[model samples]
Target: MKIGELSHLTGVSVRSLRHYEKKGLIASVRLPNGYRDYSPLTTETVDTIKLYLNLGLTTEQIAAFLTCVLKNKEAFCAEVLPVYRKKLADIEHQLKQLDQIKTNLIDRINSLQQEEQVKNE
Candidate 1:
């Protein structure tokens, strides 16, 4: 398919698809007419790319993962597992910080409520 079709199917902007090509995250073949021809695998590849981006992985990291996946399809899981585990650990640490913030906010609210009650009485 062409770039437009790939963009529409993936819901990624044509500009982004082009950027992906430039970033080496994806490839496009030049047709005789000078139009870029993209393969059907572009959809699957774009989907995976989007997934990694959503997970806060950097472009370089995504590229590395893609290289591994392509070179060792059957063992990609083994390679990806460590990266995901580290991400999970980071998320857990952030969650703990968020929990502390929530606790502090709740305590502040309770303190204000108590002060308001005392003022009413």
Candidate 2:
């Protein structure tokens, strides 16, 4: 199939498909007429790419383990484990930072409110 067909089947934009190709996350062959031709299996690859993106993994990270997953038909390949662990750790760190910010904001609000109450008396 052509790039357009792949995009339609995958519900991904043509530009994004091109970007994925450029990132080495996906590939296509050029036809004699110069149009890009993608295999039917590319749809599955695109879906996998989208799934990883939704999990907050960058294309670069996905590329590192995608081939293992696709070729072996196992999402939990050895190469993927470290990447998953790192991403989870990163998310946990962000959550801790956000919690600190929330606590600070609440403390500031309470202090301001107390000052306002004193001024009213």
Best by lDDT: 2
- For each candidate, what is the lDDT? 0.87, 0.93
Q: What tens-digit string does per-residue lDDT give for candidate 1 at 1-121? A: 9999999999999999998898899998999999999999889889988988899877777776786676567264575777777889999999999999999999999999999999999
Please list all clashing residue pairs in model 2, or write none if there are none.
none
> Which window of ten consecutive residues has the lowest lDDT sum in model 1?
70-79
TM-score of every candidate: 0.79, 0.92
* Model 1 vs. true fold: TM: 0.79
Position 96, candidate 1: lDDT: 100
Q: How does residue 61 of candidate 1 score in lDDT?
A: 72
True-structure lDDT of candidate 2: 0.93
Question: Which residue runs of candidate 2 sit more than 4 Å off their true CA positions?
Answer: none
